[model samples]
Target: MRKFIAKTVEEMPPSGIRKFFDIASEMKDIISLSVGEPDFVTPWNVREAAIASIERGYTHYTSNHGNPALRRLIARYLRERYGTSYDWKTQTIVTVGASEALDLAFRAVIEPGDEVLVPAPSYVSYMPGVAFAGGVAVPIETKECDGFTVTAQALEAAVTPKTKAIILPYPNNPTGAVMTKEQLAAIVPVIEGSDLFVISDEIYSELTYGGRHCSIASFAEMYPRTVVINGFSKAFAMTGFRLGYAAGSEEMIAAMVKIHQYFMLCAPTASQHAGEEALRHELDTDFAQVNKMVSDYNRRRTFVYNAFKKMGLSCFEPRGAFYVFPNISGMGMTSEEFCHKLIHEKHVACVPGTAFGAAGEGFMRCSYASSMDNLKEALKRIAEFVDECRK
Candidate 1:
């Protein structure tokens, strides 16, 4: 019997989210706030565009870089939303969600054993994807004290002789903490003189509240070294469509597209068209619906924060995204233990913060992406559990 496995494949552990989701599946009567997707459907115009594209028999693959129209639309979308310009022909590459874009970016740039910096409590893919591409994942802890902003000092401390790139996961996952322009500028000087690339995962770029989202790519000097990874999943509730795009300098975009060409060929043709339509027509029209969701989430955020405060479990007030990463060290339990017990005993399903990284310990990520009704039920269960634990 052959038991051959690559060292990289063997070293990789299963995702923490999948582990908890799997455990929750066997538990009965659970109210889960562990999901990471938006609760809204893809808006009407976007759906129509996809269907219309299909009806017109645009079923085949377009090109290695995806449909030209979508690329240009993405350029316009980025420009209008973040005030960044990406030349459609030379700088944009559509991908199979942001997932493939991440893979391709790593493949394009990472050399074997090259050091890649990743902040704690970030999206799960950065580490494994970098490792699979033969890059070392250097996990840096970004504490809640600084609103999860990666400071220039912290970044400078993490960089080494072998460091090749840094993953900036903002409007960050499982934290909902956003970086302000001032905070973003705080790290600019660190990379200004370096040869390292910045792989900014702006997946939740549009979900921001309070201030407009800023792109690291907006800085002209850093522009050449920045690769912007964003998608339709979080912003427009188009997860199933699986369309995302990356924009960067010509050399880097072309390098990424080379891997994308041999690997994915093209993103789903229909979905790409729908996404183009999403950028062109539905964004402004759907802002009301999008804002409604944001407003609802803000209300839910206040409720959860207040409830937790009464229970003596204060968490950061999330500014963007739909997650609340609460430090539950006061609960006197490991995050996994707390989450598992909550699922089985209290009938509530929330993810252990350690699912994001070691620095994520002593906390739990409760997402408000699910319905408010579910949130209410989960909070009641949580209160009951808190009372029982206290006793």
Candidate 2:
């Protein structure tokens, strides 16, 4: 059996994020913050749309590219919001989730031994996805001092002739870091010089605070070479629907659709109908529901940041997404050790920073997407645990 297993599949480690989540699930009275899911239910309008779709017998498969209407809406939404344009008919693909869109992008572009630059402490799926696509995942460490952004210097240093593309996980998962337009511009020259393409994971795009998210695809020079990945999961709280999309050059999307057609056939038809409704309602009402959720998340983000500060932990103030990455280095334990003991001692679960990448060694990621009461209780327990560690 062991000999029959593909070496790559067998050797790859399981997700570090899920390991603690599984452990926490087995324990009683645990306030698990290990997952990055939105606590809110999918907006009523979106859910109702799915119901209507099912009633209308939309249970069958959609076109391999997705529902034409949904693809058009996605293209419009991206262009109106980010100043990027795409031809829905030829430059878009609907995937199982942003996760699949990511995988498709990797499989579409990568050849054996090609390198994909991943910013460290990024979403866990990235490196593994690259590996599964037979590409080398080269991690470029983003620093706490630089607000967890990939600087031009670091990106340039990591690139070699083998490098084919880079994954831009802004509104980053563990760190909640976002790149401003100016920050994105600084790296354009390097990307242009290397002739490398980009996979911009903007799953948390709508969850940004302080300012709007600036997509790299909005840059004229980069737009042609960038695949922008996003979906309904984060903003609309539609994770269970398992729908996401990718938009880019016609060539890139054609390649992705070729792979997606054989592998997934299409995203769920009912989900695509729901996604279309979500976007239509958002556009009509100016994103009223999504804005409300973002506002609530902002409140939680502040609470979490302040709680960490009061507990004497060094935490970067996150401006996007719902997670906070706080440095737990002073606790005299490794990230895994600290997380393990905290969950056992306080019954409050968080993901170890090392789960994200090697650069996350001294940190831990806590999602603020829980209810206010849950967050309040979790923070109180965490503070007590911090004091106990100090003693």
Q: Which candidate is the best by lDDT?
A: 2
Worst 10 residues of 1 by lDDT: 281-290
lDDT of each: 0.86, 0.95
Q: Top model by TM-score, which number?
A: 2
Clashing pairs in 2: none
Question: What are the per-residue Cα lDDT tens digits for candidate 1 across 118-201?
Answer: 999788888999999999999888977888879888899999999989999888998888888778787888877557799999
For residue 242, what is the lDDT in candidate 1? 95
Task: Return the lDDT, model 1, position 329.
Answer: 87
TM-score for all predictions?
0.96, 0.99
User: What tens-digit string does per-residue lDDT give for candidate 2 at 1-391?
Assistant: 8999888899999999999999999999999999999999898888999999999888998899999999999999998888898999999999998999999999999999999999999999999999999999999999999999999999999999899999999999999999999999999999999999999999999999999999999999999999999999999999999999999999999999999989889998889999999999998888999999999999999999999999999999998999999999999999999999999999999999999999999999999999999999999999999999999
